[model samples]
Target: MAPRFTVRYFVRAADAAEAKARALDIALEQTVEIPRDVVPKGYVEDEILGRLETLEQAPDGRPGFLATISYSEDDVGGDFLQFLNIVFGNSSIKPGLKVEDIGLSPGILSLCKGPRHGITGLRARAGIGDIPLLMSAIKPVGLSTAALARLAHDFALGGMHYVKDDHGLVDQRTAPFSERLKACVEAVGEANAKSGGRTSFVPNITGPADAILERAKEAEAAGAGAVMIAPALAGYDVARMLAADPDFSLPIVAHPAFSGANVVSPDCGFSHRAFYGVLHRLMGADAVVFPNFGGRFGFTREECRSIAEACAVEMGGPKAGVPAPGGGVNFARVPEMRAVYGKDVMYLVGGALLQEPNLIDGCRRLAEAVYA
Candidate 1:
């Protein structure tokens, strides 16, 4: 038998009989996408079709059954998108099915090299030791390049380990991508000179497919410590390509800009851990950013904790990445955040720092809060 990858799915069905039927439906829908009778026999049916592994009642008390399905490694042909299609593609459109987890075999792991500069590399670049990293965004979108650069300078000087452009800050009339990247990089450099701190600037490089790589290389040329990309917006494989490329050694931060639907549903799309943690890590995200619990977004404490665990958990050979919880995070929540995520996270506090009477002092306070 050929090596296979496993995907655990939550199937919303009332009884065992219905669950069995749904599981069969998933096997067909995810693989051949044809009627069972029409599925060609021999190697096609035996090796290409998804094989049902197990089915049981969901442990979450929901009216569903958890189903595990395995697919041959040849089905992916060493393609990441094909792997995604095998995982959820057509079944994603059907209701009551959520991706719970993915088990990648050694063959699948060899297809894509995970994060190059994962947690350890990122920490070394920032000159930090075992403490939770601090990151803030330069934002409010419409600001000019100079204004954003100033914000980056203050944040870095005040001890923010990584300062990034807001995901929304694309090439607007006020601040083009090149200008913003140049200014922010220079600003952060000046701050590092003054404070003797190893603050790194991260510019959002999410754009057209052709432009994405160009912007990334340009940012690297401009002395950016890292580049942020919304894989959901750009492309998941784009993140993987950047992380896997030896020439572009800068860390890649995975932002959850357009990926809410993948995890917000209780019984659809993907689990928080599978999408933000496992998938992002597999795609070479050095830092995966998601909305924190108690924020404007409706993620629960359990979901948030699960995501954190998945990022750092032992999973074959992929290097562990950082879990960055952001939306609506504030300094007051640092202690609680630390208690929940421990020291392996990157505390992402954005707007809260901007609200401070003095930006630099606010960031200084945030740093103190994280370490204290």
Candidate 2:
């Protein structure tokens, strides 16, 4: 057997015969993309082609077969994009072929360059130790830099470890990236001075491709503690490229702005854990934001919990990513969230905190609730 990594996909099929046909289709569709009659008999057929290793019925009442197919690392060539392509490229376009798990081979893991500042690193930077962390966003867009800065200040004073820009708050005319980044960083600094907390402003760096690196460097120079990117908006590789850059020191936090479609489907798209947890961790995200269960988003308790588990699973090399679940989260849900996610997660509360009569006090109350 050639050196290869496994990819587990759920193929909708009624019986072994149908399952065998679907699995073979996947093996060829994902690799050669040509007719079986034409697969030349040699290295391409034996080594380069995707090999279906195992096929078993999905557990319990699930209506599919779990097909484990192995693809050679040679096909990847140490390229992250190609790895993604090989994993789900054409297969994603086909219905009833959902990606369940991605098994990284030794060669792939060596190329991973996983989270530079994953969970523990994030805590160290925020001067926090073990205990769930708190994060809030400065939002509603269209606001002036000063107004946004004030919000960052209040959130920091309220003891949020991270105060990030709303994903939509990019370089708008009212709040240009440079102006907003400088003001927010300074405001958070002042708040930290008064509160004796190490809260850091996290500016969103998702924007035009040519300008993202410039913004990241600017954020670092402006003293922002971390930076966020809607990888689904910018590009899947954006986070990975930023995380891999040696000069970029700020921790990378990934936002799920346009990623819902990839996991919301019943029998298509990637699994919640595969997309939000493994993908973000593999992309070097210190933390990943997703819609929490009980939130306005329709994620279930089991789906959310699986994401949390994947974030901290014993990967053994790459440091664990932190799962930050938000969307309609409020004070009433703190205990429930804690029970579901434990201490390894980051509690992200946004609009609810901003709607409070006193933003600072609201944040303080949330921090208190988390600690309790």
Candidate 3:
């Protein structure tokens, strides 16, 4: 009898039935390597030492596994990234191999603080309570800094609570990150002054990995409400670093950009919820953004629900992160989205607001819908 870790796979490989049957046969008969060279050591025996059992079917009829892996604190080697890599490192490549839940021993789980600023903290900052928060994005990436700032002001005036830079809008020559950040923050402040509203302007701080923290600090100094980053693009460790920084404490929003490739395959990669939910929370994202069900993205309705559930579910931490569903959400869809996501969520709508002939009116309509 040895110590074991639990791994719950949400989606199995498309051909997992066959692969799993082979795996089971091998497990019963002899030694088996889970992900070939990725897990040189017996992954089943090493990481999941004691708890290796299979469930009948996932909610979607995908098969799943609950394995008790044997992982050593020594093997973790005192690195969080390494810990994540060791646990889900290799399986991320196999389609349908999503590590749903990691039953870390008390000692291990203790090391993970999830999110420092979660749903409640976010609500407190936004000065809203018990209602779905409405968010918007300043976009198209081609707009000048002044034009983007005007967009931010319009969204804030319209009553949106959070405004973020388009993920694709980075430090382009047309709109340098610093210029865009200053203009947007100032515009939001000006709008707030006139409207007496408290919309949050969250700029995208996805700079070179080394400069991310500096940019985050700069945004805070510029009166920005919160900041966003694509951990997969900038580096997941960078997000953790921002959260851990004592000088800048704005809420961190995690975006899913380069992450699609990680979960698109059925047999390998991390599940959408796991990447956007558990890991984002663990890395200290106050809000985690993902494509919504009805969006152009291929995420299913159940997958969207699972992501929302993961954000709000009790994990015994500061508070649950806000699940911000983005990707073509609009005002007309607010009521329906709210019904599905409920009150304790953040609704992220982009492009639509920008497309509105009257940005302020559009924002107001969205705000009204969310509040209604």
The lDDT for every candidate, in the order shown, is 0.92, 0.89, 0.74
lDDT leaderboard ranking: 1, 2, 3
lDDT of 2 by residue, 239-337 (tens): 777788878888988999888889999778899999998878888888999999998999999999999999999775778989999999999999999
**Backbone clash numbers for all candidates listed:** 0, 0, 23
> Model 1: how far is 23 from its true place, Å?
0.7
Any runs in candidate 1 off by more than 4 Å, and if so which? none
> Roughly what TM-score does model 3 have, to 2 decimal places?
0.86
TM-score of each: 0.99, 0.98, 0.86
lDDT of 3: 0.74
Q: Best lDDT goes to which candidate? A: 1
Displacement of the residue 54 alpha carbon in candidate 3, Å: 6.0
Which ten contiguous residues of candidate 2 have the minimum total lDDT?
104-113
**Stretch of 10 with least lDDT, candidate 1:** 107-116
lDDT of 1 by residue, 89-164 (tens): 9999988999999999988798767888888889999999988999999998998999999999999999999999
Instruction: State the displacement of the C-alpha of residue 235, model 3, in Å, after optimal TM-score superposition.
Output: 1.4
TM-score of 1: 0.99
* lDDT score for candidate 2 against the true structure: 0.89
Residue 143, model 1: lDDT of 89
